[model samples]
Target chain A: MKIGLFIPCYIDAFYPKTGIATLELLEKLGQEVEYPMDQTCCGQPMANSGCNRDAKETEALFIRNFSKYDVIVSPSGSCVHHIRDNFDAIEQTDEVRHVRKNTYELVEFIHDVLKVREFPWAEFPHKVGMHNSCATLRALRTASMSELGEPFFSKPKTLLSAVKGISFAAPKRPDECCGFGGTYSVTEEAVSARMGLDKVTDHHDAGAEYIVSADTSCMMHQQGCAERNGVPIRFIHIAEILNGARS
Target chain B: MSNKPVPHAKLAAEFLKDEPHRHFHDERLWDMRQKRDEQMHIMPEWQELREQASRLKEHTLAHLPQYLEQFEENARRNGIHVHWARDGAEHNRIVEKILRDHGHSSIIKSKSMITDECEMREYLEPKGISVTETDLGERIQQLDNQLPSHVVVPAVQKLTSDVAKTFAKYYNTDPNIDDPHALAEAQRNAARPVLLSGDTGMTGGNFLVAETGSFVVCTNEGNADLSANLPNLHIATLGIERLVPRMADLGVFIRLLSRSALGSPITQYTTHFRKPKKGGEMHVILVDNGRSERLGMDDFWTSLKCIRCGACMNTCPVYRRSGGQSYGSVYSGPIGAIIDPTFNAKKFSTLPFASTMNGSCTNVCPVKIDIHDQLYKWRRVLAERHEIPFVKREIMKMAGRLLAQPTMYRLAISGTEVALKTMPRFVLYNYLNPWGKHRELPHPVKETFHSWYKKNRLNKAKQHEETQA
Candidate 1:
């Protein structure tokens, strides 16, 4: 399968290793991948800030960058969700519409499309908790599907559970946003920090050594909180773990 | 009085300073939500019911004018005099006129956010008509002569001791009373004399069904029932958007509403009054109060779909921690953030930017109003009107300019990382960095992914293209 890699601006700038892990994991699964260099952003930063007018140029840039690929995939659920949900409104060009239809988040892409039943490598022996990002769980309707279907094929937790030696513990409230919304962290800084602290506390209280999630943005925020508090709990992106990277 | 509007952030900061025993409240509410969701999930039809309720609300909103007319006609036929008010002042005047006509000096009111928004108490108290708020939470805030911090849970910010102090000051009760239930009973006892002597009882309607010429008011404490039923004259104020097409539609809303708001299967009392019982007078006031104008505007019409369950408030992270008072509106939390700006645009314009649009409110809404989306839309509208703070506008504009260009974005990211890493932590923790107050900035990674990807992936791709050629 030819997969077009969509590097979200945040991933491109801050955490390139997540992108590398995604690419390596996909390749190891015997999937062909193409990285579009010109793909700067999914226009989320602008669109989410209520600046869709400013996003127009970036939207066109997005369409131009990855229109031809059959399956466009991104490591971050939030970025993929932004494109799938909001791209149509950013001038519904045929290419943009096609990209929206074809795009998938990494976990959904791997589990749904590839049907990978198990991880290629053994996972580290530690208790892990999964924090669902808001965009992925709510916007993509991943939570609904997880509730309905089989363990392997349906839920993200089930998919994460397949990693050998990794025991997944449920959160006090499943699927709550960690409140690290783009620009929200800055604009409503105090509230965002409190929310992040609460989420980290939940994971810490769960006896989980590591908190895993699909979106690095949320992980980064939570990780910042953990580091600042000098808590030993570690944050890992699901893609990094799925790709068999151990901390 | 301070000229400046109540500083919600400062008030919240003060409240959090002590870190009062809010854990029990949070834990209890969270537990209730979990149980509610479990019950809701037991019935596979819950999602369908939500959809049905959403559609019903949409239909009602689409033909609001006709349904409202029908409601008015039915209400009049049932011996309930119907009045229309264009705005808050007119609504208050018409309400006061009714009181004046009856020669009533005092009236008992249940928790009506609409009335509060209209400054009804402020207006009526001056007219020598004592409006006693009957809801336990509202009554507590009333005793303190403070605006309700929350729409549903009026005194959500107040600890039991706060209520005890307010009760002790106002009703000369024991300040030592720390038990919530005891304090509530004391509040009820204080309100009892006022309720009995009051000539008219006023309550807010959750919905007005045009088909039955009836309105429904839901409450857990039965305050609305007591307020409306006990008095000789009962007055109900309903926003124009509150109308539904038929009585049956209430079933769907009632099921979704309580579940969403307080996480109950249903509120204790869901009273529907078609008309006055026996000989008692019933008056229905259909208040436009800027709603009809809001419905005309496409971007905001969806806000009218709200059932005012306050579910959004419960789940909102910003609201949960900061409390409703932080929003500085009669309506607080997510729904309030949207509704307040619509009613008083200039005064509450900063509300939309007060929190992150986490989209949890949208997810948990019983009526399924895309609240976070509307919040984003409101931000756009506010920005267009230059309602956003000047600093925010400048920052956004600069971000827009930088983010528009890939090179600039890449350069800016690298530059920021370099600057942050080299600079001392306190240097970056200045007032300008609002995040610095509570959150420590994450250390910048030495190498950004863009550079790594360019070196390892993009370069390889170019070399492969050359090799293929």
Candidate 2:
């Protein structure tokens, strides 16, 4: 399958290592992956801020860049979520529909579409807490949320379990938002930062050496919180771990 | 009202300044959320109950006029007087008239959020009518002259010391008294005389059963029962959306209400008011207040399905972290963020944006109100109506334009990188930087993915293409 790699603007700039990991991981799985250099973002920031009309140009450009690929994958769950769910600012043409239907977050792409379980090259000895972005947990249904009282299942955890020497740290509220809600982190910085501090502290107190998540957006905010609050914790994207980054 | 939006973020920042209070508030609500999950875990059919409750609410709302008429007719047969209120002003007027017609000078009411919405106390106080709150939490809030923050636990955000201070001011209790039981006793002592002296009683209806022409009031403290039966004149005011088709349907709600609200099996008192006691007059006022207009909203109509169980608020991380008072409305938290907009779009515009849109509120809602989704939709509605701040809108416009063109986006990214690398610490972290106010900025990177791809994969792919050609 031809996979179009969507490097969200933040990943493209601040967290290039995550983007690199995603590309390498896909390549290692023996799938054809293409990074369309023209792609910048999935238009989540504009659309999520209630400026859908403002999002139209970016969203259209997104379709223009990735229309021909069989599937579009991003390391950011929120960006993929925006494309799959809220990418409605532009007209619903066949190309738009095709991109929306085929776009997948990196974890879901590897777990559900590719169905690749074992990561032979990946081994993480550190105890890590899994942070599922709200978009990945609730919107994408990648895992069973605690609120639903359903049988417990986690796609991210499932994939991580397959890795050698990987143990999970259980935070009290594992799936609570890390408060890096695109524009929300700045707009409501006090509450947003407090949530991020609490989130990092929760994992830290649970004895986690590092926090792993599928979305770089959340980890960016959380790393800032951890560093500022003097919380002794580290952060990594799921792609980095799955692609066997030694820590 | 000034057209200025409520500064929820500012108020929340203020709330967070008191670390102990903030910690207590977050933990207390989180405990309720956990208990609610425990209740759900035991009930094997919890999701099914939510579906039934949601469908029943939607059905009744669809035929609201018919159910309302049926309720009015049957309630009259049960010796109840019914009144219709088109808005908050009308609802207050109806209540005031009921009190004045009976020559009543005082009313002892239960914890009714509808009365708060109608501003009944503010309206009636100048008319020489006194209202006393019988619920412990509400009485604390009433004595403190503050709005009820959480719908279920009105004083959940208040510490024991705060209550002691408030009671000391009014009930002549010691300000240093730290025991909650003693504070409750103080309130009970002070309110008993007022509860006994009041000539009229008022309670909020939790459910208005159309089939039986009766209403149910669920309270942990049995305050509603006392408020309804203490005087010869009883008034039950409820929002129009509280109707259930039959008594059987009431069981579904009753089973879900306390479990969702407080994680208890049921409230201490789930009293059914089918009729007035002999020689006592009974009145039921159905208040629309903006509910009819809200019902007409395409994306927001399902919000009426809210039973006000407050599960959404308890489960909401934003609501838990930011104290409920920060929302600056009678209804606060996830439910309030959606409902408050219906009252005044401009004044409460900031409420919708107060959420992180985490979707926990929607998951925890007993009736499945889709609260977080409504918050998301409300932002779109407000933006289209120009209710959002001009600066934010303009910024988004610029961001959209910058992101649409890859060339400009790359330029801006590199520009940001250079600025971050070269800018002074004072310049980077200043009053204007909300992100830097509490958190550090992401570290500057040497090469972005775009640059890395160009150097590594893009060149290789180009070379391969040439070789194949």
Candidate 3:
């Protein structure tokens, strides 16, 4: 299958390790992957701020670049969510429709599509608390969220537990948003920062050494807030954890 | 109303100065949401209940004119006077005229948010008609001369000590008393005299039952029933959208209402008022107050489906952290974020942007109002109207251009890297930097993913394809 790697702009710029891990892990699973250099973003930042006119060009650029791939995958949920749910302006051609339907965030592709039960090369000896980034939790329907009380299971937690030597401590409020919220982190920084701080405090209280999530956008916001407030916790991407290889 | 409006972002930051209090406030409401989830688990058909309630609300709103007219006709037939007010001022005037006609010296109210929307206390109190709020939370806020920050838990943000002090100062209850039950009983005793002796009683309707021409009001405190039962004149202020087509529909709403609002299976007082007491008057005033105009704007028309159960506010993370007062609207939280912009864009413009668009409010909504989506829509509408900050418009324009073209995006990254590497903290974390005020920027890496991909991954994959060909 032809797989396209769609790198969200912030991930491409700030956390290249997540994109690299995504690339390496997919190849380890023996899937053909292509990195489209021209693909920058899903036009979320502009469209979310109500700049539809401004997002149009990026939207067009995205369509022109990655429309041919049988499957397009990104390490971020928020970007994919914007394309599937909020692309109201795009002409709904077969190609545009195909991209929307075929595109998946990395974890959903792994949990729902790959359905892997074991990771022969992965090992993470750490107490990890998972952050259910809001876009991924609610928008992508990746798992039965803690908010909706069912026999509870998580897609990220399922996959992460496959790795050897990793323990999971679910936060007190497992599904409460980390509050990175794209531009909201900066626009409503006070509430946004407080939310991040509280979230980290939950994980810390649960005795997590590191916090991991699928969307680096959230990791970026919370990680920055943790560092600023001296919260004594670290953040990482799910891709990096899944790509973990032991000697 | 005329001064410069401080946007939600700035006000939220100001509120966060007291971070310890903010965390405590969040946990208290979050516990209610957690309890709501516990209640949902006991009933296996929780999602189904939500869907049926949503559909019923949608059906009622779609055929609102018919249900409303039927409700009015049925209400009048049952010896209940039905009055329609086009707006808030009109609604207040109608209530005042009712007071005038009856020669009522005082009125007792039981948690009517519509009256707050009408600014009724300010209107009636100055006119020599004293209005005492009967709901305990409302009574506290009334004594404090403050708007109820939350709709369901009017004083949800207030600490127990604050209520104890209020009770102590106002009613001469134990000033040092801190036990919740003791303080509550003291206030309840104080409110009993005022409520029983009042000439008129006013309350808000939760649902207007079209089939029976009766209205439903739910409360845990039993204040509405007490006020409605004791007074010679009982008035209900209902927004036109508060209608259920059939009495049978009550089961779905009754199950979902308090569970969503307070995490309880049902409110203590889910009283249905179909008619007046013997030799007394029952009046139901139907207030539109821009709700009809909202029905015309199809994009936002679904907002009328709100049940005002306050579940959206309870589950809202932003509202949890920012508190209700920061919203600067009669209604606060996610619902206000959407509804405020619809009513007055220029004044409440920041409310729409207050959300992180995390979309939790949409999940918890009993009527499934699509609140976060509406908030997004409101932002676009305001941006189109040029109601957002000029800096945001300018930055979005530049970022849009940079993101559209890969080369420009890359070039801008270079400059951003340079700025991140070199700029002083004064510039990055200064008053002008909204994000920088509270959050430190994640420093950009030297080599971007595109650079790494181009150097190693892209060409190798292309060469493999070439060999395949």
Please report the candidate that would top lDDT against the real structure. Answer: 2
DockQ of model 1 vs. true complex: 0.47
| Tens digit of per-residue lDDT, candidate 2, span B209-295 | 999999999888876787889899999999999999899998899989999998999999889999999999999999999999899
Clashing pairs in 3: none
Question: Considering chain A alone, what is the TM-score of candidate 3?
Answer: 0.97
Could you give candidate 1's per-residue lDDT for residues B1-469 as a string of tens digits?
1224345555555555555634544554556456556656676787787778888888888988788889888888878889998888998999999988989877888998888878888888887888888999888888787788777788877788877888888878898887988887887888788888889999999999898788899998888898998888999998888888887777888888887777678889988888887878898888888888888888778889988877777777777777766777788888888888777676677677666666877767778888888888887787777676677667666766666677777777888778777997778988887767776666667676667777777788799999999
Q: In model 3, which runs have C-alpha deviations exceeding 4 angstroms?
A: A245-247, B1-6, B172-175, B424-427, B458-469
Per-candidate clashes, comma-separated: 0, 0, 0
Q: What stretches of model 2 exceed 4 Å from their correct place?
A: B463-469
Please, what are the lDDT tens digits per residue for candidate 3 over residues B1-469? 4335546776766767775667677988898888888888898999899999989988988899999999999999999999999998999999999999999969988998889988888998989999999898888888988877888888877778888898989889887887999987897888899887999999999999998999999988888888998998999999999999999999999999899988899999889899999999999999998998999897899888888888889898999998877887678999988887766788888888888898889988888888888988888988899988899899899877887898877887778777888889898778877666666788858888888888787678689999999
Q: Which candidate number maximizes DockQ?
A: 2
Between candidates 1 and 3, the lDDT winner: 3
Residue B271's lDDT within candidate 3 is 90
Question: Which ten-residue region of model 2 chain A has the weakest summed lDDT?
Answer: A39-48
Arrange candidates by DockQ, descending.
2, 3, 1
